[model samples]
Target: MLRIHFTDADLASTRMARAPDALWEVAASLHRFQTRAGRWAYAGWYRTTHARLREQRLDRIVREVLLPLFPRARYFPDFLTPDQSSCADEGLDAALDAIVSTPSGRVGRELALLHGYVRVPAWVRRLTGRQERRDLVAAIRSYHEVAVRPFADQIHARLEAGRSSSCRELLDGGVQGMLAGLGPGMRWQHPVLQVRYPVDRDLHLGGRGIRLVPSYFCWGSPVSLADPGLPPVLIYPLLHEPIAAAPASPLTALLGRTRTTVLRVAASGAGATTGEIARAVGISPSSVSKHTGVLRGAGLLISSRHGGNVLHTLTPAGASMLRTDT
Candidate 1:
């Protein structure tokens, strides 16, 4: 377990990132390609992403160069994901610069860990070389464009949804409540936020508050920068639909206005309870329960009991049925 020791000052300064970090998504998406864990959640996007990569002949290069460097293992280089930037290209530029300028000692150590999992290319050995740097940058940019860019709309929607929900957590419960509700494998007990980490570790945040970054691609448990000395930030997964959603024609046609609104409310990824949905749609709990039962029966939503309340979220089909306004 990873223990994040927080001071009172840290609580005051905790903040959520307004947007997704591009370079981090690139890394996380690569991790997704190697697994079947969350396949059901991102099925639609996964099928198309693979086909596009293979068609462009980018899959081989990505597998050879990028995947090895950013493996789903313990020690991906921190420089590959820079602090948030206004644009993906801007973030990529900064991250690439960091890679090229990384100290040889740190590069060797990190790469040694990476090499343990996969063979490192000869070009990767010469980190500071201009030609090698250019090659690496081009490879990352190509992969991002081909495999990741097509789902930009879905990514943005998930980021926005996560930010909105996080804001409500902050308002309703303050920093401790917000942290506790981050996701599974996380708990907040006063001064320390505990996580079920892959490796046991601890973070002593004396005063510098941690940045809570919501990621569309981060899966399983929340991930933190390996080096504790760096500025503290936690990258957590967001509940997202696999593909870009179209307007719910079939659902709307089948269910009428009120029930459709109820499904749409569940699809918001907020895990709202019955009462919350009723309040949002101006209906009563009994009415909300009726709508939810029908939706769940149709496999459009799933409700889980959380203490006295039940929280609802969309299933794969449910997410596909809903429309996102880009």
Candidate 2:
């Protein structure tokens, strides 16, 4: 179990990431490649990435460098994922910088840990060299382009949904409610929030607060930075049902062009207000309202009154449809 002790100031300062942390996604998604854990939830992505790596001739780099560094069983270096990142490229740069600037002592420690159980590849020794560090960065960039970017839209949609739910929880019940409702095994009990961690640990926030990051790829349990003194951050898996893809032609046939466009616009996670839909789909508000109404009737959207305006969001069915269209 992991107990995260929070102060009053910590509660007040807690906030969610505005967008997905790119490095974190890369780190967490590696589990899919290592095991069959999230196979059902990410079968499509796994199959696609598996083929892409082979097609792009990145199999060796992935197997030799990435797989060992991002093993499923034990700790990898925390520097591989920065505590926070503003954008994907920035995060990638930060991760690569961490690799390049790693002290030989830390590299030796991490290698000893990995080598304790798993078979350490001979080439991993190059990690401490400057030229080899650049090669590692190139491998990461190529792997991400092949393995992650293809499913970027679906990943973004998942993050946006999680963010919306978290924001709503924060608004309705404050930090306590939001914390309590994080996931199945998470419990917020007064000064400390408990998680069903794989190992026993305790984290004292020490009034520094913590950043709550919702991850599209993190599975089973929430993860935190290994170093206790780093700017505190907790990455929890998004409670997303695996959206099943279906034939888009049927929906297109049923709704026709403009209404189908509206459905897709809503599913794009671009702030699903009628006006936002209007602006996004290049249609008037009246037309957006009319189309959203039909979609709501068809069980593709759910609309709620938000003060004077109505917010229309995609239903699970609608999200499934969009995911299928991809």
Candidate 3:
């Protein structure tokens, strides 16, 4: 179990990443290749990514350089997923720059720690040299471009939906409520947030707070930095459901134009409230509610009540329909 000790100030400062962390996504996507545990959840992604890697002739690099460095073990070097990479504005290029500029001494220390858990290739020792680190970064960028970038839209949609749900949770019950609803593997027990982990540990966030990063590729247990002193972060898996292969023709056809517009508005960023949908669709609030109720009944949308307002977001089935329609 990993117990994260939080203070009152820590709770006050807690926040969620506005967008997916690119480097963390790279690490988590690599993890997907290493295991078959949640293969069904990512079957479509797995098939496409695998084919793309082979087609791009990047499979060798993934197998030789990337896989060894990012093993699905207890630890991987913290330098690989830098704190700067978590910024919403800074993207893959900035993240790669951070990896290349990481202090050699810190890199060496983390590499040594990785060696403690698993055998690292002798070539991995060459990472101490600036040129070698640059080479590694180049390979990482290639791997991400081929394997991770192609699925950017799906990833963004899933993240937006999750962020909407989280925001509603925060408004409805504050940070603690948001924490409680993070995932099944996590439990919020007052000062400490207990998480099911491979090894037992405790992280004390002394008012620095922690960033809750929702990852599309991360599965099973939540991941955190090995060292306790780094700006705290917890990358947890998003719930994955198989998207339907067929288009949602019947549902959309039955709803006609206004209801269809409401569904589209609800599918927009972070979801929409009844008022937001009404304004966007130019319909009355009662009409918006009637439309959403029918969609919700069909499992096309999910509505959560937050005091007087209700937030509505698309289910996976609904998202699939939008994808097909577009």
On TM-score, the candidate that comes out on top is: 3
User: What local lDDT does model 3 show for residue 145?
Assistant: 89
Task: Give the better candidate number (1 or 3) by lDDT.
Answer: 3
Which residue pairs of candidate 1 clash? none
Number of the top candidate by lDDT?
3
Clashes of 3: 0
On residues 102-146, what C-alpha lDDT tens digit does candidate 3 reach at each position? 999998999999999999899998898889989999999999888
* RMSD score of candidate 3 (Å): 6.7
* Residues 123-188, model 1: lDDT tens digits: 676754556767887888888887677777657656766765776787899888789788777889
Task: Please report how far candidate 1 places residue 17 from its true position, in Å.
Answer: 1.1
- What lDDT does candidate 3 reach at residue 159? 79
Clashes of each: 0, 0, 0
The C-alpha lDDT values of all candidates are: 0.77, 0.76, 0.86
Model 1 lDDT vs. the true structure? 0.77
Q: Write the per-residue lDDT of candidate 2 for residues 1-326, one digit (tens) a residue.
A: 98999999999888878777877788888877888876787887788888888998998888878988887764666656765353545666666676677777777666776677578788877676777777877888888888876766667656765666677777889998889878777899998999877779999998898988888788888888777977888888876443332346676666776777777656643236676566645678898888888889989899988787677878899878766754
Locate the minimum summed-lDDT window of 10 residues in model 1: 240-249
Q: What is the lDDT of residue 40 in candidate 1?
A: 79
In candidate 3, what residue range of length 10 has the lowest lDDT sum? 242-251
- Assess every candidate by TM-score: 0.75, 0.79, 0.80
